[model samples]
Target: MESDLSTSDYLDQIERLPTHEREGQLFWKLRIRETRSQLRHLFANSRLRTSLVISLSIVFWIGLFVLFYLGFDFVVGQVGLPGATYHAQTVQFVFTLFFMSLQIMLIFSSGIILYGGLYASNETNHLLTLPIRDSRIVLYRFQESLFFSSWGFFLLASPMLIAYGIVVSAPWYYYAYLPGLMISFAYIPCTIGAIICLILISRVPHLRRIVVGIIALLIVVVAYTSIWRTLDIKDADLLGAAWFKQTFRRFEFTREEWLPSTWLSNGLLEAAREETFDPGDLPWFESGKYLIVLLSNAMFFHVILLWVGGLLYRSSYYGLNSRQARQTHLRMAWIDRITEKLLWLLPRETQLLIIKDFRMFRRDPVQWSQFLIFFGLLMLYFANIDRFRQHRQDINVLAWVNIVSFLNLAVVGLILSTFTTRFIYPLISLEGRRFWILGRLPIERDAILWGKFLFAASGSWLPCAILVVSSDIMLRVSIQVIVIHQFICLMLCIGLSGMAVGLGAIMPDFREQSPSKIAAGFGGTLNLVLSAIFILLTVLLTALPCHFYFMANESKLQTQMIPAGNLLLWLSLGLIGVVLLTALVTIVPLMGGFRAFRKLEV
Candidate 1:
């Protein structure tokens, strides 16, 4: 029947065939059933986990809302900039710039998610054996990938928009239109991302890592130059009204109509004015016209993806499977040699395991690429610290600098927690059904766990410490502040790594093959919750002395004398508390994980 009909009618003919061959419908039906089953199972079996995740999400959302509310309030209250026009235009430019940058991120994130879901997944491989068209599987996986790619967008955007709505006295409908607008806008980048991932895999198939690396480098360079130029203003008043005007003017190029982010931003801005786009008049809105553009473009992409996506997925799937194998030598022995020499203090078994894990990490573009992008962005921000802080003296300067330093520490710690949860927590689980082979090896199970822990701790610490130190140097903070930050960085790395490794053993998901799937499971969620709580305690304990010292110094900037003895006493207490806390957090989980690993049947 499919052959009898033209290509346009192919889908229509599928329904007339027997239900068993109705792969498209079957896939979706199965998906629906699976979703319902998973939700039910989650609520029935893991109420605590469900409640904790939801609660953290709510708290984080509320925190973001409050932060934005205060920022918008500062602007509208005539604190940050002058004039109502400056307020509106500045915020509007911010909205456009923010969404435009977010759009770029979604494209990259969506591509990565799709690459993992499509070409790299065992599930995709299994699905190929079924009767479904490869496109349906791509669509199926796209649904999952979209959720992973876009959740951050929703989390970050919703609160800011709400704050904007409240600040602008927007109608109730602004909040109502918000979700729909965001959903539509999200699809635009994700579609572009899907197309990019498709072309890369189907065309290059090999050399993907090199090509992706070069492309990523170019984007970073472009972003760096753009940001550097934006901030490299000379002779302009750093704390002047003109600075706001000139800085935001550079982003005016994105205010054009054709861009989806522009439409989204303008639509929201207009909606706040209790108006819609008039298309022909001087009114700010498009009278829901921009919203309609988003919806229509989103729909167009959805349809296009189903058609074009299927063809690309089919070709890539078959081509990848049938591609000829090439024999090439890996030039990474130098890495092993260097690592072995550095880790010579450890036993040979543990050293070998560390080297193995290192090789695996270095070989996988997916893992290391994400690691670089996230840390690279943070370091890039740190490098431009002078842009944010003027190289001048002022009342309470020491206090403000002290506060910012601790905040940067907390931020770095938070980001490190995510990496540990995503990558470290899944390591043992990724070992999965291969444990029997490992059991037969002469290496001890303790060595296996220690190797992972050491690998995570040592690997994470250097970069985090460098970032913290670099930010401090840029801020021109005192030597005492830098020394404290370095100490905290070391503690955070060890504690967080141990926590993830420990939790992985305690809640090993041997059944799941995908690292992401494993990471998204209960263990990863629990690990994140614990890590957050741990970071909060660490920051509070370690920062109290520094904060106190700065407040005193700020109170008497001229001939100031905070007693060295008193300062030393407080510092000692703080260090002791932080060290004890770090010890507890690290040792407890590791011991638990060690016990669990020892008793495993495999």
Candidate 2:
């Protein structure tokens, strides 16, 4: 009988054809095939189809890099002194602390990625059933996580490093050393993260919640510590000496001898400051120590990870696949009761949809953890407003207060936009392959869209309003300013939520399972771009009136030329324009979303 095996089957047979080919060669072959398949699918459209898309993407990335480079260059120039290495040290300290903090965050995030099925793709699942060693599987997943997590670091750090190099006039070897350092730095996190995930899977599955809670506690502790350190209210004996001492002490912690950040910083700075470039007299032994430390540590941890995986992979994989009852049922029941009481007034269908959305959000630790981190960081920054005021005495205090409040509005609006893009924009698309079940229900698509909007808006609005009101209170701004900012935040909430929902519905992607992937598609890109533009315009509209008022007030006091009545007339017209713009932004996108969702073929 003729063989009826498919190509994949034939490949498998060929793989088993040689016993020596089962380990490294087999893994590479599978990986190569998988990568090529993805690439082909990604570029399946005709050449003309995505030309505009490609052009826009290139422009966006180039603009981002240019913006960062310019910003870093400006910082270096401003901070550089005529006869000192002060600017270089400052930059090194900042980079070290930043990378250290990022490493900590990556450890927690990696555990979540593994536990939450973020890497549980169809290909990975299929690979698990094959004859490949579990160590190879772990290695593949580690590489995937590392690649996904490192891009942001590369984009952010490259410009700063390049700017630092330019500021220091470093040699070519200094530039060459940077990529190796970065790669090693990236490897440390991936190795540590993989180990964390494996340990959690093998030892304590139920401890994930506790780990997240501990991370939250750590954030709170750090926030409190920062506030305490920065908000010293003791009256200083007014002398130039005290101010100089305080300024010098600001970064004392960065000089600690024990930190990896310190090592990395010192290494980079030493390499950059090398005065000789002659091949015979290179500072190999001295400058090379940091690189060796970084590389050895990375290799050490990665080897340990592989060894641990080889021992624990089978049990952990089995445990990870097993279905265990979640322990939060009682807490969820209590929340459901509260939700029921709150939504008793809504229609039954809407109530059910809202409840479902809440349950889904609550069950997903990856989603909620991210929400916590993003907003928690914002809150921490907001909590430091009093400290900001104490330090910024050069400008008119009230003028500074108003400026910060207005800028706070923009920042909070931008946060809302990001939240909507990351979470809300993916909701409709996240229905995924089971969307047909919704079609079978007796509910209207409008109800579904409305529920998502209301839920997302209300969720986003509370935090944003708190941020606005708390900052205003901290700054002791006038009640008028407080109320105005609150109003603007409310309008922003509606507009952002509406735009995300509408754009998501219009360009739903049910094929992609990951929220991050879904949000990186064309619709998500457009939503982000439009949302950013909307925020800019809104800020300008609101700020224009305030700017006019401030200018008019200053001129009235200084020159007595501009009349108060003229100022009032301009202010009234500006307020009217703002109100109209807010209404249009709030309403149009929501209606568009509803209509688009209704027309969607289930």
Candidate 3:
């Protein structure tokens, strides 16, 4: 370390230097150069990773766009009267719901992300040592938090809006305004989250988490009550006008002019509705009005964020660090005891490793909070799933019930895939810098991979199993279907966990400290793509035989007799195929990861 006198002399010399306004410009200019350098490395050094990620992303995007196009076409051409007012209203209503849901998700996720970055990261400490203003640093980090939280928002939102544009035959201006509108709309929730994060940390350091919990609870209450009311339909009303009315009414609040989602949805729909291709058409004014509203709000929020950050950022940093330094004891919970008891069959080292991973997740609110928000939404929907069911023995209805059950299983599996991708895939990569400690331990390197796999599998299984059971119970499916769903859930947990852990070992990013960045890399993208392919196959195989069985059993007048033996044989074959797929998915990855772990240099 340099002597205090020398450090003081250097600091005094630095203070005497004049600050140029363009120094801030210089920072961003350097940032762009660094980004270009990284992109060049991605293209030049990692061509395979680049190609695979791009191809997979395009496939995913095109698939979603096609689904939206078909749905919109059906609603317009097949549903209700051909030229009816209902078509436009229905499209606008859906747009409102889509943007509104994304708004709530962005705000919640942004808060969690900001907390992890602003308070928890060591990088923030390093940034504070530079000559930059605290507000400037906060703004830089805010952009990161926004991007991290909203990439999924962009991916899901853009396709739907673009598909709607095609269906409506909108003017090119609609597509032109889309990127700007989305950016402005997304900025609102993220700004709100940032403001809340700063105030909570700076003013009430002790009550920050409690405040966050209260906010989350409020959001949950609102979401649950609103959705529950919409879903509280009688079985007799299935596919009837009454069910549609209630559902639409529940989401009607989304159209309130005060809401930013309403602004975006209205802007897109209005612009999409314009038939004229003229560059300066009078019809453009309607959409342009909402666009102006969105932009003005974004600019206003931008000013407020900088002001708030300037006021609170530095103090919040110090106060937060001071508070953490004084806090030491971590009391063990009953959950830990139960976890140990449940894993008694595992070796001591493996058990300890699992326990360590469990604690880390528990300590990180960003991880568990997201888990609860997403899975909790599913849990809510599953509990209320009976609304879509009808007791009538109509063959179509019964067939739909079976189809939906299989779809529910698919949904749960897809979500678990994302969970594993986001959190589990980073496990080995996170350990890269710290492998020396494990190297000195008595445990073999292979145990590290196994421990992560087991933790991912068991931890994901419980909630997913509950979700599947609840969905089946509410749908009133037969016990056989429920058993099948449970089996599929187990298979998904094992396969996804194995894929994430294995690929994580194979292509670990030891140098990148951020988990979000790690998960966004090539390996995580591959794991996600593989998981999706696995789910598609599993659902197709299982749903086909079950659909046939349901159709044969539920029909009032049987046109063709179907043998129980044949149905059983088909179902058995599907399950056998699924089992083999799951085994290959789980085993191949784990074995590969173990081999890689053994040969790892660090």
Off by over 4 Å in 1: 1-24, 79-84, 275-287, 326-332, 387-391, 550-564, 599-602
Candidate 1 — what's its lDDT? 0.82
Alpha-carbon runs more than 4 Å astray in model 3: 1-21, 78-84, 234-236, 275-281, 324-333, 390-393, 550-563
Which is the leading candidate under TM-score?
3
Candidate lDDT scores, in order, read 0.82, 0.71, 0.83
lDDT, candidate 2, residue 253?
Answer: 74
lDDT of 2 by residue, 275-321 (tens): 55666655435557888888898889988988987788778767766
For model 3, how does the per-residue alpha-carbon lDDT over 1-602 read when each residue is reduced to its tens digit? Answer: 56998999989976764364555576678778978997898899889978998899889999999999888888778554313578657877888888888898788767667777777677887888877667777887788889888888988888888887788677899998899899999999999988888888899987765665666667667778987787666642655677777777778888898999999987887777654567666545788899999999999988899899989999988887777555555776788878999999999899989998998998766677678777888888888777666444564677778988999999999999998998999989999889999999999999988899999999999999999999999998888889888998898899899999998998888876778767867788889988999988988888898778656665633544567668768988999999999999999988889888999997
User: TM-score of model 3 relative to the true fold?
Assistant: 0.91
TM-score against native, each model: 0.89, 0.82, 0.91
**For candidate 1, what is the total of clashing residue pairs?**
6
Descending-lDDT candidate ranking: 3, 1, 2
For lDDT, the strongest prediction is: 3
Candidate 1, pairs of clashing residues: 276-285, 276-286, 276-287, 277-285, 277-286, 277-287
